[model samples]
Target chain A: MRRRSFFQVAGATVAASTLVLAGCKDTEVVQPTTTNVLNLGSNDAGVLNYAYLLEQLEAAFYQKVLDTPPADMPKEELALFTELRDHEVIHREYLKELLGANAIPTVEFDFTSLTLTTRAGVLAAARTFEDLGVAAYNGAGKLFTSKAFLVAAGKIASVEARHAAFIHDLAQAPAFTGVVETSGRYTGMATALTPLQVIEAAVKFFPFTVITSGLPTA
Target chain B: MNLFKIIAELEKVDPEVMDRLSHRRSALSALGDFSKKMALAAAPIAVGSAFNKAMGQNTLTDANGILNYALLLERLEYSFYDQALKAATLTGTLTGAARTAIETIRAHELAHVNLLTAALGSNAAPAPANGFDFGSAFATYPGFLTVAQALEDTGVRAYKGQAGNIPRTLNPTVGGAVVNLLTVALQIHSVEARHAAHIRYMRRGATAGAQSTIFPWINNADANGAPAVVYGAGNPVATFPAESNLAQGGISNLATGLGTTYTVEDVSAAFDEGLDNTTVTAIARATATF
Candidate 1:
């Protein structure tokens, strides 16, 4: 959903507070309502922003789910969601600090496609998001010039993969194949998508368009 | 005269020549002597064989060495799955989704082997298909899952360790190739983590009450269900802590208030740590016995 739409649902006061705590004014980070494109810069900055955007989307997603938790959600599952949300927020803020002024403004996400009221729907959507995060980090790591950044991405990618596996099992008990398996492309490795491919899949849940040409291909 | 200056003088006499042919022969002779001195004392003939091996494997200095190490891990992982899939008892032991996951993981591992082998080309390490004794590593499905978790976790750590070996820039062609290989390594690395997580989940499924305590993410080397003993105590102290490490980029998640309400354990569960080459190789060697 658009930022305004999310603010409307979550209450503007809370949104403003969150923005301030995240280290930026809403006006400084959020773009004009008419401008729908978010440009992820080039090189290391672009990749860090790429990661930051994904983490923001994940953190927001988990927060929204927790805020309006389905009544049927089990306690264990609720705890899992809380942990996932916390991890993503940690990752998002870490990238923001690493990127400093170069970081992309907080991009708006649209989870309208998901049916958040049901356990099955939430888990399934989480599986998709988690898997996408893994794939995106996998592909984006090589684009970074700094070994420090590559290793950092590696650290995060593995955790994302774990989350993907857990969520996949939760979505379909005993169906753990999807998270670890990929088609026999790229020499039988798991899915690793270029920025364009990742952004294409991710944009469906984003309210605004993500122009990924600024991101590296290799 | 300095070697380059001599070569430059030689070039004046013969523009097509890059360096002196006699000098190249002497360099090869010196390399042979160095290899002879480094050869296995028990088997003098092994020196010739070692010398015959690709130069890339001998020089573990840069990206080539990283690619070689990656190939070794892939071969190990691929053979593990390949043998497990072929085991006669596996058919009756693991059914349904578990079987499917195993098959899928096998395919990915084999793919990684092929991809890394292709990337390494002549420098590819010897495949240990004949040497890998799956029976010793894991005889039953549950045993298989335990070892699978170990190997996959090791693979993830190994790749992360080697990632720093990739040079940021080189000749465009070589640099591009390194980047492609590094990307491939990253892709396979996360897949390995997924494999570890799923294997942990499957183990939890078999054990009735493990879910509440068991986590998919790596904790202290001894945490969760990680078989630290199988890895042996010979592992360097630095590498052991690395597997279950809770810190990253000098920032401790233990400190509160970045943006989460999770406790210390949850914070630790949120990140996987990287293993250095010595530790990863030791673990791989211990497991490779079977």
Candidate 2:
């Protein structure tokens, strides 16, 4: 009897949201708004739809970086950036397919603020993108419906964090070259962000409509 | 969001559907309970590692093979997090958040273990219990930060390293289901990266480095008065490793219609400090040297 309640509490998935086929047809879905850059349709699918948006932003940003390598870029840095670029591409493509038939349209972007012409500019751009990427995942991980998806989010967000740290270390490495530092105890200022916050930052690069009415906040 | 409220609301919405989900959850949970119990039951009678030896040498075959390898890595991660969270004397809000996140990660790892075990079935050999050699390295508070950096960073690279194992194409050669899980796996890797960055930001010395550095070439930082320069030490960031130089020939190279001069090794080393798994030990030793 005790176990029954435990089972209900632990097993309760969000109403009928998850079991339904990719729920793009939820006409109740709010369109993208000025405030919300990514219009996740609410619930778990909305959250993934949110992720799909960010992946598209990142993939596009890095795509340009590769397309226009700046002058004086080092063989090493450019190569690393390029490798990172490929990853963003893969992420963008992978996410596009993940939504199945119900995926959001691939919104266009303008990362014009990023100066891909110089080494420092490129690294700085890399830093911002990496930071945003990690934060986007951080905010979204809790919203995931499946244990498999949550575990998978852990695997990828850490890579984004690594990218952020590598850039941090490169620009101002801690005593140890690769060692990442902690400013406060938990690092809330860095890692724990909401989708709203992430989208705010993301819009600086990609000015898309933000519509997240249906996404379950919890 | 409060997990309890979420559960309550979910139960209220559809008791019938919730009941089925509960059954599924219990079934999975039972499997988890049984596997753990069996592991414990066998520990006394059988040599712990004898099971792995019987599974034969690590078979790096299809997606199943790749995930098992990842499960092994995640087990190590889950253990490290469990011990670190237990040992840390985190202060105030940071402590609460860290504890929650540590449990979240631990839970996530366990779920991954369960899911992968289901996928592999009898093929899933309980991985040998490998002891992490952190020893007294992460004992001190500052030392904890440093070690956290290394572990999180390594975790990131390791995921990137393992991604190649999952078939990337989905032509019926890979199927949509494998692709879906792989995408989820990638998402999880990103989430862990965020955790690492959070730790790394906190570990930095308060006074060190330029507090305010402008992001040059960003017109808005100057034009709109958005500080081109990011200011001062941030709140705790994740403590944040790598692999071979296999990604030397990336789309970036293809963008220019020429290959990059950088080798895969160099890029791997950039994020993954200890591909050899020696960086942690080396850093520990180097701490005394400098």
Candidate 3:
């Protein structure tokens, strides 16, 4: 009789737990922008999409610069802007292909906070994006499960670093070199920022919410 | 009471149950359970290895290949700058700014060599003791700059090519160490890139009318007025072709509907290429000094 009572109680508990688990699973299907979060998914998909978003932001910024270049910007500078625009566009499209259905939709950016009609303004903006891009790659490379994708990210990163160095040099010949230095002597190291840190820096440029909740922590 | 005896008895009773699992899957499942139990028991050895990896401990067979290659590159770079600085060649041929830049580059390369050597310890390959011909590499100011540009650019590509291998070979049991190694490699890679741009900028300063033809970025071995001799025989002999490549990951920069007005050269300049092991090894071998 005691064993029968125990069995009945155990069965009831199991049924109740199942219903609770089902309810919890239902809540896990994150709604988009409803509670102000843009789920970036998990693992490599999340990292790639994060990269894609950054590329999109950069591509849009360069496009804007080319669309209405600064008045005092030299023809040489304008040519550079044109090249940068194309590079970012290529990067954005390639990342899009890599992400396929996993990628986030087009993100609307707001660069209105910065003055875009001046060479200094444009270069400063370029500097921010390029440096941030390099750091993003550095911090996130290990999170990828694919070797090919990691190599691809590294290849793109060095190019972005080159862009950052050039733009920084163009703006202020030697000042840009100092930015990469954090300690005594030349470490030959660039900046590296985690996803959360990068998001913090990138948030101001973005008009919409960017949810990085599901992104890999390590 | 032996577990193997019990398993053998169970296998005899239910061969079909054991047969359902492939040998590899069964072993893996056993390992998974063991790890779970180990986790519950708070195994110190596993925790210690995790700590070691996080602290940048010497890798086993897996990641050591990449670390050794990086060590080789750092050694080559360190020797390159060491010779230039010791010879006082730059004082006569280059400006103070250029000299300062080279000094900064040398210091970084030395730091890199030290870091890699320490991380690799006994596993590290012996430093190149002899047999390199940089005489032509440093014969003239232009020659010196050309070689510097090539080495820096090569260093960037070599690191990029091997970066994927580091994480792939990293022991799954000690993931943090892999991240540590990658972080070190990337830090050096970006710095090398900046050095490449800095060298290009200095080279541009020497060009006629400072034409800005090179734009301080890689172009189809643009040579940007660095004489054809600069791409001479002894230099890496083979890996130069990929430096000018305009495509990445089988995707052409000129593919249709890309919607960009940038020319092929512009697109090529925007992306850097990764060099395979043989190519990087050859390049490193070509640069060593006796």
Candidate 4:
């Protein structure tokens, strides 16, 4: 009788736990309709989508600048900006293809905060985006489960860093120190921020909420 | 029944049983029930020791080796910049901006060396025995910039190549610390990229012997008179291709995929490549006298 009772209790426990798990999954699917949320998914997909989103924003910013370049922008600076636009576009398109069906939708960015009319203004905004992209890649590197994806991220991370350095130099020549930790255990290292932190900083640029809850923190 | 006898019998049925038991994550999951039962009877300290034993020791050794390799590289870089800065001949020709940039890079290298040393503790490899002799690199300002660019670019690639090798153990204590090394290496990798860009910028602006054609990013395997190996392929060309190679992630035709209007230089500059440890060490040895 004791053995039979034990089996019955075990069956009940399994059924109850299954229901709880299903309820938790349901809550995730039924988010409130008031705000649009961009879920970055999870695991490798999440990391790629997050990168795709940033590349989209960067590509858009450069494209806008190239469309209506600053009157005072030098010929050489304009050429450099054109290269920047092409690089970002390549990155955006490449990442989109990599994500395929898992890719996030095309995002329309809100660039009202940026001043794109003058050379200084444009370069400053580029610095901001480039620095953020570098930090995002650095932070996302350890989260990748696939070695190929990690290598891919590293390839792009350096390019982003190069872009950041050039923009920083052009915007504040002679004394521009690129985005690096000034004082700490990681003094020489570049800035690396979690997805939550990156999204928090980048939220102002996005029209919709970037839900990074599904992204890896470590 | 003896545990060994059972394990031996199980091995006949499944050859990979021992591998599964030794695998960090698998071992931890396998021990869950056993650990819980032990916790009810044994002390918490004993449980912690059991966890350590389950988490293999080889991971810690591998982590230390990577850290020491990085430490050696940083020390070499720091020494290179330190020697150049101390030389009046090179600094004499450098503009104020150029000098300041070198100073900034040197300070960062020093910080990296110190950070790695602290992380490695006793296992830290001693500084290179004879110190580096940069040879003619410091004889001229442009030469110094050339070598600087190569070293910075190499540093970026070396760190990227080792990223996957850094073990991600399951033991919370060791994993937490070792994983930080991966993060730190990545953070430093990008910083080296930034330094490489700035050095390339300086090279472009040189009044004499200027590599004006060279942009901040690598273009079509152009090493800018630094070694060709700096931009060449590693052991397995497929895994580590030349910087000019447009293929990425199995997509052979990036130009066609993106647009034909995107020139080869644009596509190539869009991404950087990593160098394997063997090639990187050979390059380092060539540059440094030690």
Candidate 4 regions off by >4 Å?
A1-35, A173-178, B1-61, B168-179, B208-210, B259-261
Give stretches of model 2 more than 4 Å off. A1-38, A172-190, B1-290
Cα deviation of B197, candidate 4, in Å: 0.2
- Model 4 chain B weakest lDDT span, ten residues long: B1-10
Task: Give the top-scoring candidate (DockQ).
Answer: 4
Tens-place lDDT per residue, model 4, B39-58, is 22222222222222321122
True contacts kept of each: 0.47, 0.10, 0.36, 0.50
Model 1's chain A TM-score stands at 0.80
Better of 3 and 4 by DockQ: 4
For each candidate in turn, the TM-score is 0.73, 0.44, 0.73, 0.79
* Docking class for candidate 4: acceptable
Point out the higher-scoring one by TM-score: 3 or 4: 4
lDDT of 2 by residue, A1-218 (tens): 46446535644232123212112233333345544355667665567677778777776777787778778776656665665665555445444433444356767887777777886787777777777777677566656654333433443455566667557655553311122213222211234457888877776766656766567654
Candidate 2 lDDT tens digits, B27-115: 32322232233332322112112111221121354766666666666666666666666665433223543445456555555555555
- Docking tier of model 3: it is incorrect
lDDT of 2 at B233: 10
Error of 2 at A216 (Å): 2.0
Best by lDDT: 4
lDDT by residue (tens digit), candidate 3, B60-83: 236778788788788888888878
lDDT of candidate model 3 versus the reference: 0.63
Candidate 4 per-residue lDDT, tens place, A19-103, comes to: 2223223212213234577788777678888998999999999999989999999988888988998899999887766665566
lDDT of 1 by residue, B1-290 (tens): 01122222222222212211211333223223322333222222221222222211112457667777887888888888888877875667777777787887777788777776777667777776566765565566766777787888777777766665665443223313433656666777887887878887777775323455556775445434445743232233322234444444323333243443455655556666656666677677777773
Tens digit of per-residue lDDT, candidate 3, span A27-115: 12223555355677777667877888889989999889888989999997788777777777777876665554455676678898888
Ranking by DockQ: 4, 3, 1, 2
* Weakest ten-residue segment in model 3 chain A by summed lDDT: A19-28
